[model samples]
Target chain A: MAVSSTALVDEVVADVVDRVRGTLEDVFAAVAQVAERTTAIAAVRAAGRAPTTADLAALRPLLHERLRRRHDLISGIGFIAEPGLLGDVPAWLEWWQNHGEDGLRPLLPDLDPGTSAYSDYTHWDWFALPRATGERAVAGPYVDYLCSDEYSLTLSVPVQHGGRFLGVAAADVYLRHFEAAVLPLLRRLPAPAALVNARGRVAASTDPRHLAGSLLRSVSGRSCGPIPLTLVTALPAPRP
Target chain B: MSKLSNGALHAVFAPVGNLARVDAVVRRLADAIELGLLADGEQLPGESELATRLGVSTVTLREALMALRQQGLVTTRRGRGGGSFVTAPDQPRTARLGHRLADWSTEELRDLADHWAGVAGTAARLAAHRTEPEDLVPLQRSLEEFEAARDPAARGRVYGRLHVELAAAAQSARLTKEEIRIQAEIGALICLALGEDDARAAVVELHRALLRAVRDGDAELARSLAERRVQDAMERLIGLRLTVAG
Candidate 1:
């Protein structure tokens, strides 16, 4: 029975890892496509000059379509431009998100550097990690009070033009939706299990001791594909 | 509730420790509902599970649930597909706040303020070191909201939110969660003193200065600013309590 349970745990862990990786990869692929299109548009619009905010604004329709296509999984999707790259603004986020039954709407965060309400996106891990490494990244399992007021995971890919770091194309996944999609597999394991980010923060868990957003210490698990997540199965309590 | 909401709910249901068990349980659930940590109409864990989580007897859990029901913070239904569900209470009235403040002794208030100061100061200092200038935006917005608030209750909520955002800027999820729990415990009581115009103005200046210190990356200055702000608020609250007692 113990051997069978161990095999079941391994199978469940692999399934959970695959499900999470598949969902994240879909978002990354969609955002990467958006980035490629953005680069192409920037080249055509700028034509040897710096692209203006209007040029960026023109991509709004594309963002709306992308958001609509993945509405079930993606709560928001858009591009965050490098400061001064658009010529007209110090910072820019041409983002759109689902606003309940009212459908998708543009995210107009405060951008003025002098104001208290400015939403400087430069420091956010989703934007910063990809920009720094020039690679795709997954940021969070944290409450996203700024956009959804829901716990979220933001996947992003750096948008580059001729090796010049332009910005990032990103998508927000509601952690609730992610959980709804992934938790059943976790529940299938006989032992307590969890999916944790590289930072040890639990993204989802069947282990009551390791609740989501809480850090896991001395965790052991297998990495979930290219994403920095691990599937950890806790040993069940021994019988008294 | 989402799984993340489950994490927060766990904090709400954490063991009641050695306090008046039933009362502590009631307060924990009540505060979570009022603070919007528990969503309206959200189902709580089953009684057995909840009892185990709180380290209370089923009987004690029932008594606390009954108290919550009377307070209109929770409702229970019978039969299948039924469980206790949260019903967010209205904002605690100002008179109720005075009564709540009266419950705390001067020494207890001082101790609470000390803890608050320690947490807020650490958060501010770390935010100064870790955040970019742009990351201060949410803190700035919270400050403006506090200044524009027309009533004491609104000011109190915004004040708590500002500190919570400060922890968020520090980029420590644990700190942010701690700030939320602390706010739920003492947030409403602070409204007693924030109602005064002079007190409000003083806080506005302190918040502005704190923001500048964090923006300039002066970690020690930011920590001091944060500590002073909380201590000042505590002093005002203590003065009010004395006047009422006299």
Candidate 2:
């Protein structure tokens, strides 16, 4: 009986991890498509000369179509240009997102560093990590007041044109929706379990003590997928 | 403050929880516009929809919009794709801030300062325990910006951003959201005290020291430094209030 129960626990944990990985991979796959298209456009534009802001802005319809088609998982999608990549502008982000029944809407963040309201995207992990590492990244589970105001995870891929870094193509996934999709699988575990991001912040958890957004103290866990997320389970306390 | 897109929708449309619903709505909307959560010339949701989102009646929202218009923070259009639009206000003048400060008692200011200190100190402690060195980069950049900022308005923005980033480094979304909300309420007022070069320099030094403590993983030191930083700023603000009163 004991051996059977242990095997059952392992099976449940594997199932939850699989589902979590599958859901995130879907989002990343969508963002990867955006990055590929963006890179192709940038390469074409850069071949003639450095891409103009107008050149990049022309990609809006493409982004809008992606947002419309993937509205269930993708809350926002856009490209952020490397500073001075577009010549005149120090920084630029051309982003669009679903707006309930209104379809897609553009985001307008202040790019000027001098202003009190400026949002310097260079400082954010979602942009910074991919830029520094030249790799895809999952940046949050944090309240993203900059784009979605929802607790969200941002998936992003570095966009490069002929070995030159242009910027990044990114998408936002609302944490509530992520939880709604994953919680049922987590509930199958006999022990309390949590899904945590790279930094140990809980993304979703069956344990009230380990609420989403809180940090998980014990770092031991199984990596869920290509991403750095971990599935951490806490064994029930021994009988008193 | 508002960044554009769906985030702005959340900030602008989140329910107002105050008993004085109209006044609360007016303050919330005005704050959103001033903070740039609502872009200049951006159209607000239609009245009934906005009312439903805010959990207020259309009559109350109308009254609030009227108050916002009177303050020059919003403009309304009549027909044919007409709706209320945000008119971003200029930076608050010293005289205007003085008048706003006059509304708060010294005791209330002290209470707010204590609360602010508690939040910041706890966040710093958590950050020290949780954050990687690379995660501190934004805080470092913010400190450098604070040092370089010549004016109080710019310094105030850097100062508020540092604390918000500190909360984020702690990996607590609730704490980060709270920090953002608090900054919106007090950020403009902080400019009044930061106008002094000496005060700005002192803040820069304290922030630098606090960042170092967090980097070293000295949680206790980080907490005390954060608390001291808030208390010092509170004293400067109180002194400014007294001067304005006199």
Candidate 3:
């Protein structure tokens, strides 16, 4: 019994250690690419006409193509008048509720539902954009798309123009990209790593088996050594 | 449920009760019973007996059965008909990274840079601290190769590897998933419009600084430099208009 218990602890430690190391590496690599392209004085100068509607319209297809190429992500983006139909906070929430995956629905109750400024949604708004200049940044620890269960974390900086909201010219890195940083930290200890948004839902997790259903509020604080384990009391226990 | 002499089986599962592991065992049992690997309506040995045979404890074994029961993959009853019976097969669902990057924002992109620089720096520091002196040769070799490479595609490949290695070193799933999201988001974006030359130039400095940090075991310095490198790199993308001007 002692031997087996020791092995279990060992396995848990090993897994956490393994995942943390991975997360670190993954995060560095993913963040490293943020500066791959930029708005050169020449490039921005190339946009000399203040970007007319025709220019914008003509650019969508190419931008979409650009968006598609850069991320290969299911969700796509472009500069639009209304943040696009699904981009609006309320609409996106509603869309996600109705047309999205069940795994994602549980997170909605926590959304503020009042404005477009949720940290997860609009941190890129003028107010938050230039907060970081010639310095470090941690973006979206935030949400870009809710329906897809896509959570994001980024390393970025703001775009500035004489201290004006030149727009948040930054590289968008996905949260999953940080797996290399987080998982290894987790693998080092017996505890699992997960995020529970303010609404008391499982935001993201290492063991899918340890779903929002099985997560316990109590588990959030309990630590076995430095490794923390979420108990099955707070969230619904896994689908047992 | 069947009256299985699962004493041996229960013994086998006693120690492995984590839901995921148990889930797998139940799935296997479902397959086994269906394929006649274990007979239908067979009265298997008791948990102890089963545990003894499988080299697990009855507790773990029962947890597996319970999961199968919950999945409707098995049934348990008391008395003679009280054991575990195969009922349903297992199914799988998964998440993908590509789907994630679609909704990214400028702010989030920057955050990705911060996290990587901090955590990866730590991992490098740890590796430098713990790696055997003799083992440093291959590490140095890998570094040499990375420094020598200049092709964007090659850099991209190296970029992928450096991350996995860092993750393997930090050994955390949290880092791995975060890295996945960042890589998928950036990778997809680059595939969208970022040029090879653009990416290579952006990361070369960061990677080189990171190597230095690792070599020096300077976690803090590694983190700061790595972060600066990432932020500088991210600034490469052009910004979306903050709002549609009236």
Local distance difference test scores for all models: 0.76, 0.78, 0.40
TM-score of the first chain alone, every candidate: 0.90, 0.91, 0.36
Q: Which candidate has the highest TM-score of all?
A: 2
Whole-model lDDT for model 3 versus the true structure? 0.40
lDDT of 2 by residue, B1-72 (tens): 234334334545767766788976876676555444566888888899889888899999999999888777
Tens-digit per-residue lDDT, A1-240, candidate 3: 122366776665455444543433333333233222222221353445332333333333433343344442213222211122221232211111111232211123223221111113333321143353444344333333322223454434343333332233233344554443344444344344564432233434556655321222334422222212221212344533
- After superposing all C-alphas onto the true structure, candidate 3 shows an RMSD in angstroms of 28.4
Q: Write the per-residue lDDT of candidate 1 for residues B71-105, one digit (tens) a residue.
A: 77788988998999988667555544554466678
Question: How well is each residue in A49-132 modelled by candidate 2, as lDDT tens digits?
Answer: 777777777788788887878787888998988887886577788888888887788887666555544457776788889999
Higher-ranked by TM-score: 1 or 2: 2
Question: How much native contact recovery, as a fraction, does model 1 achieve?
Answer: 0.00
Candidate 2, chain A: TM-score against the reference = 0.91
Q: lDDT of model 3 at residue A39?
A: 25
- What TM-score against the true fold does each predicted structure earn? 0.56, 0.77, 0.27
A best-first ranking of the candidates according to their lDDT comes to 2, 1, 3
Ranking by TM-score: 2, 1, 3
List model 1 lDDT by residue over A1-240, tens digit each.
222466676776677689878878888988988898889877786667788778877778778887778788888998889987887777778888887798887766545422222246676778889999999999877556455546689999999987889999999998877888778777776767788887666788887755676556566888998998888876334223
